[model samples]
Target: MIVGIDLGTTNSAVAIWRDGAASLIPNSLGDVLTPSAVSMTEDGTILVGVAARDRQSTHPALTATAFKRLMGAQKPVMLGRTRFSAEELSALVLRSLKADAEAYLGEPVESAVITVPAYFNDRQRKATRRAGELAGLRVERLLNEPTAAALAHGIHQREDKEPFLVFDLGGGTFDVSIVEIFDGIIEVRASAGDNRLGGEDFNDVMVELVRGQLKGVDALPLSNSELREIMRAAAERTRRGLTEADTAPFSLVWKGREIRRDVRADAFAEAAAGLIARLREPVLRSMRDSGIRTEQLSEVILVGGATRMPIVRRAVTRMFGRFPNASIDPDHAVAMGAAVQAGLKARDSALEEIRLTDVCPFTLGVDTVEFDRLGRMHSGVFCPIIERNTVIPASRVHVFSTVRDNQPVVEFGVYQGEARQVDANVKLGQLSIPVPPRPAGTVRIDCRFSYDVSGLLEVDLTIPETGASKQLVICDDADAPDDAAIAARREVLAALKVHPREDAANAATLARAERCYEAFLGERRDHIGQMIIGFEGVLQKQDPKQIKEARDEIERQLDALEGERFL
Candidate 1:
């Protein structure tokens, strides 16, 4: 059976298309959204979701979360003596989702339609597809998250002629898209986003607020883990409170004393003002790129949990002069849309009557001849094959002549991006076509660029003069390490001796954090002294084991404190 999956940064969800409707499959705990966290028990068993997240307070060193932000990154993450690529870590999450789906359906599910941010570059998209494959699921298509949300919105309304904008701000990514619906056709005219921006930024703001408060108390010296654990809990609560209340009450026991603070809506908005401002660029740019004015957008649809913020809504309303649509649950829209796409893929319902066309968010181009000075040949010209806003399922061809006479083959460098210089763009891959050895001008190579609904690009190099050709699917050839290699690396990663959960690394992190806190505390030593005394009171009641445990917790809090500054 075909299913839909939303592999999010902080959470993941799965849904199936059945009985002409879409239904989300809850996890074992009956939660529609599962935390994207994993932890290994001392016995070697792997735990996912809430159990893993719960362990973060006591075992922050062993738990790994938010790894999704590293997708397509060249760096490797070291975990439990095993090194894992971002793709591999993502695969584990997908595998967990797949297992849940199989249990719900009472059958083995083999294929799915996965949703990604519309602005995900070729490398990031390819990594996501590979992740699905590693999890034993055949990815029929990779739908854009915003586009998928738009599809769900369109399906619910059954509108035949109207245009709307979809703004998706999830845990770790943001996407803005403009879609036009006409005669059962849903076409995405433009897509834009910052892959690194999301609700996490809001949590960082809260963390900073707490750290700032603690710094005012000058006498206490807390460890990193202790500070991180406290701040993490505080940030999480603040994020949840923003969804329903104008302000959130925050309190945490630090250094022994109970510290209390209230975060008002205005303060929250002020702290995140920079991020809110940053979000407007993409919305305006997307609208302009789609050739659709803000006034032309009939409705602005808000999806993803981050959009629940009043600040975000106000920012978008100011830009479009209209209240955004929230008819569909923000958290469920993407998965529902994925289910809709699954229905189309499985041909299980009449939803197949609807068609969608999406475009590559970035420009696709190649290197060409620029100019020569004093008997020299310079190759720096960037020739674009397709511009950003062009409709998808489209192809463009460019011809280039051999620079040297009797050249056996011509090399075509394929790239993606809008940079005029080749160095500034991504080198997707290269294509070389064999041709009859003839004069430079006698050989003709036609380079064709085609992007499909999945946003995957295909490049074909043909020597129409000699009827010789070579085809390269860019996604299939990127220098990603194979699954076997990744697995082998993971084995090595697992063997590496990671610092103990309560090791000296925690102390060092805490030392650095304490310095920052002390610097910030300045003259607030009296308040800090009271809190430190309270912390010691709690510490005195604990046995040696408990003191060590408290120390570990304190270290985690410190990490959270540091994380706030960096974020």
Candidate 2:
């Protein structure tokens, strides 16, 4: 059976089409949601999901999270003694989701449709697909997150044919889409986003607040993850609390003195003014690029958990002059919509007439030189062949000539972005075209960029005079790993041991206890230590029901202990 996976930055979920309807598949713990976290134990045991997340603070060296933001970057995530790329970390999350789906369905699942941010370029999209392949699943399709949300929204709304805007703010990325829904079709007109903006930024706003109020914070370098975790954990808890209350108080032991501060909801708003301003730009840009008036949009839909914030909602309202639709749960819409797409890929009878089309999120262009009035040449100018927001499965061609007289070779630099200068854009790759020793103006080559539905780019350079042509499937970011490198990394992953499925509950419980043991004082800390020992003894008895009951009781105690320690 094929499945739909939302390999999100902070959290992930899986769904499938069953009984002529889409359904979410529960993980081993019988929960529909899973944390996108992975941790490696000192003994070389690999732990994923909740078990891994539990160790993030106490076992920071062995733990890694939020690698999704580094998807196509050249930097590697250094965990303990090993270095891993963002895609490799993502593959671990995918592998866990795959296992959970198979366990629930009681069958082998080999294919999946994954979701990506609309603004992700060709390299980032390829990295996502490569991550899926590393997890042992053939990627059936790469669906845009906002587009998936539109599919889900279009089905529930009673509109026959209407245009709407989708405001998507996830943990690590934000995307906005202007789309039209009609005749069993969801056609996306334009999409825009910043890969680096999201809810996590708001959390950092809270962190900055605490840092300012607390003295001697700078004395402790963040290289100490333990110290950083304590600060961030308190910030995160208080930030989440602001969602429910006007003011939230956070207490933390600092410099041998207890520090207390009340963070107001409005303060977070002011600190994040720049970020909120960013949210406004894409809405206006999408509207302008699509040639759609704000009033013309039938409605505005909100997707992703970050949009649940009152501040974000208000920002959207002020920009579009409408209250965004909240009928869809911001968190679940993307995953659910992915399920619908999965069904479409299977050619499910239910969606026979529905067709979806998407647009390229950014401009594809190359560099050029032009002479000024004074006869001096400027070489940094960008000439776009395919403008941003062009519909996908698109082909565009432009002719470029050699640089100087009797130039032996002509170089074609492939780039993607909206910058007006060549150096300002992201260089995907370059191809050198040989033209038989001709004058600069005499030799010209046709450069065409073909973007497919999956968001991959294929470039073709054709020489008309000699009828010589060359094609390029641009390697991701110029430094992407080859097949041999991937194979070697796979072997390293295979060598590590994964905790047994049956033992996840125990591992999670122990990690939680240790986490609490770090935060509390005296009697409470000793009590948690005792509980861990007791739970370990109970697990050795090989009693499933007994272990579960003990685990639950201890978890409740741990939660209470942590609650009392925090604000």
For each candidate, the alpha-carbon lDDT, in order, equals 0.76, 0.82
Cα lDDT tens digits, model 2, 1-567, are 799999898789999976667788888877787888888888878888888876877778888877889887768887789888899889989988999999889999999999999888777887898888788888899899999999878766636656789999988899999989887778999998888998778777877876676666433345678667666667767877777788988755544444568988898888888999998878778988999998899999999878878788888888877788989888888988899899999999977877889888889887878888997889878889888889888999998877688787777787888888889888877877788777668887899989877656888998898998988885432354677876777777667687877787688778778776776666877898899899989989989899999988997897776653221
**What TM-score would every model get versus the actual structure?**
0.81, 0.92
| Model 2: lowest-lDDT 10 consecutive positions | 474-483
Quickly count the clashes in candidate 2: 0
Pairs that clash in candidate 2:
none
Off by over 4 Å in 2: 216-223, 253-259, 436-440, 474-485, 559-567
Error at 463, model 2, angstroms: 3.7
